[model samples]
Target: MASIVAQVGADRSEAAWLVSTRREFKYDLAGELRIQLYTTKCSCRRAITWRREADIPDWINQGVKVEMETTTIESSEVKTAIARLREKAPFVYGLTNYVAANLSANVLLALGAGPAIGSAPGWAAAFPAGAGAVWINGAALMSSVTPDELDEAAATAHKAGTPWVLDPVAIGAGASEYDAILASLARRLDAVIAVSGEVDYLCDPAGRATAVPGGDAKMPQVTGTGCSLGALSAAFCAVVDPFTAAAAAHVAFATAGERAGERATGTASFAIAFVDELSLL
Candidate 1:
């Protein structure tokens, strides 16, 4: 019997992310690299059994079983994005919230991008024009900064042909106004949205959808991961299209989260290890 340690989602019958199968694997989503683990060809299908100590132990009683399909963590578009980012070392301007400011910059720097968190009077208009990419987190308005600056940044990035990323998280104050602004900016880019979960769904402007799998549940327990994701996506946007940037960023993050979770004793270690894994990638 091949004892495979695989993590399954709450509902395994549905298409879930298969995490770790005693070996490295890869999956593809949004035309980007994905890591599909656990399902490999064998003469005896019944001999395969999966175990997840962290989430679930067995699904035998639930009448659910593992699925088939496997690939390698080999050459991928994500690597290509990383290469371009390191080569060009693009300048990414971030308008992040008070809480996420430092970590977001750290993440971008680890990914080999120059992170510029600017808030000067003309920073919004001037930064994006020269920045290879821009990142605007709606939660930044939670601080003293006004939403108007965010609008100016997004507008300038759009006009200057600089790829940018938006994470509309924790829009605490002036929710309606921020919503309207996010909607307006999203419309210009065709409003592609991503809902992160155990299985991340990446929807494109052209109405195409793809699912990316991997990531540890402990990721959410840490602060600033959402903002970090936006920063990473900004780095990706500097090298690739926004759609591919979003998908590749998600994949890279998931892979890092998974690796970090594997050896981390707690959340603190996991957070540190997460950044290390991203740098290694």
Candidate 2:
């Protein structure tokens, strides 16, 4: 006999609905209610059975217990699948010299990714072995941190076989240095994951971005359009194969951004709404 388990809201009778049974069966829900049934080629019937396990074991050992009572069997396979996807969650590293960078990191965590924040050259080595993807934000640059640090970090992530996402906040908005840094990182990395209207350097692999034109425009203005992109990348990296992860991340971000727009009036509103909407995804 096979068992199908689902959440509280699912239909329990579907087990037999599509199957043609030669005999009888039972079902259980939350270990309380039991429904027993008998089926023939021409008709089907059900009756209540004993609520205790001892009474059900008589038919259980014979593999007919399923036909004797109605207890819900939780499907462990679905849990296993979710776990397997989670096992691949990316070790997200953020490099920025701005306080806003902290907000970006928090965004990653809120979206269900593993986030590491710091701009130390030492962090570069950790990228290859520990993370599935890296987010490099050129928002606030430290002259003490040479441009080579960005190059080395991107290169290390690539060598470690992880994808790197670059967030060049306000690149052309007079932050020429930031734009240059973004471009340099983009050229060094195998492929870049960037947001729209930022540094127009990278081509998104379709499903890798999370920003759109509508909504409050408040959240996007506050968090770099790249913030959602990075978080979405992190989320998809947890659930899918590399190729599809980029695409899935983009879809998730875009949909949520659009939804956030509908419910928000500005960045502050979007910030609150964005978090609320993520759980929906």
Candidate 3:
């Protein structure tokens, strides 16, 4: 005889079945098993019997019961970290593309952080002097900061041990030279790289990668979401480690996007709710 076990959802209930002959099995949402038994008739009189466990073993049941609780614990921790971020209200310096500058600054402000924008050489070095974190966004619309300015800003953040976030918007799409500059900065500076797309990819200084999935389909239709993500990253980075900051920012933004889409009629409405949700957090 053989036995099989299946779990339902967050509930601890389980269904186990014992089989003696070839049969098929199926399950319902409540975790109850439906089995079909097959047998062959014998010429001589004979009897067959089947048995099942009254309940699942304690060890097996306990294993499945803890998954949901663990997830809850993780989510609670993230919320606590966000509270700390709001309490600190750290300053986040941005050298972002013009298209995203306003949105990025507003995101930082809504999240209870200070936002400062400057791309000049003097500002690059001076901004990090008393800032909690620095963000460099390379998604220019008309003009962009020179490669040297980016390097200088990165060097300043590195020296100060300030957590920095890099958003290389369309880096390799057409600007190979600029892409090279951003790539080089990523390798040298200890910063979080937030690669925005259908799914956001976050890379830490040690080369560890974490994928954050989930967002509204309309998110891409709206500009500056990626930029807001970078700004939010800096907000979290001010109070948490770079890796956790990046992942937390992604989770916050993706969840807010999903929620905003539910109430929005169009892209413009969605954008408004997106910022509102960030402030609500």
* Best by the TM-score measure: 1
What's the number of clashes in each of the models?
A: 6, 24, 0
Ranking by TM-score: 1, 3, 2
The per-residue C-alpha lDDT of model 3 at residue 177 equals 24
Q: How many steric overlaps does candidate 1 have?
A: 6
lDDT of 1 by residue, 172-267 (tens): 212122222222223322344444556655543344445567889888777778677878777777777555666677777788888999999999
> What TM-score would every model get versus the actual structure?
0.66, 0.50, 0.62
Q: What is the lDDT of residue 197 in candidate 3?
A: 42
* Superior candidate under TM-score, 1 versus 2: 1
lDDT of each: 0.58, 0.41, 0.53
Candidate 3, superposed: residue stretches over 4 Å from native? 1-74, 140-144, 171-211
Candidate 2 local lDDT, 1-281, one digit each (tens): 11110001001000101011022233333434444334334465645343433443232132111111111112233233234435655567656555455555655655556777666657666664467556554433442444556556655755555555443332221222322322332232222323233111222223222222222335446544454454445444445543234434444444556688798877788866776665454
Q: State the TM-score for model 2.
A: 0.50
Clashes of 2: 24
What does the lDDT read for residue 230 in candidate 2?
49
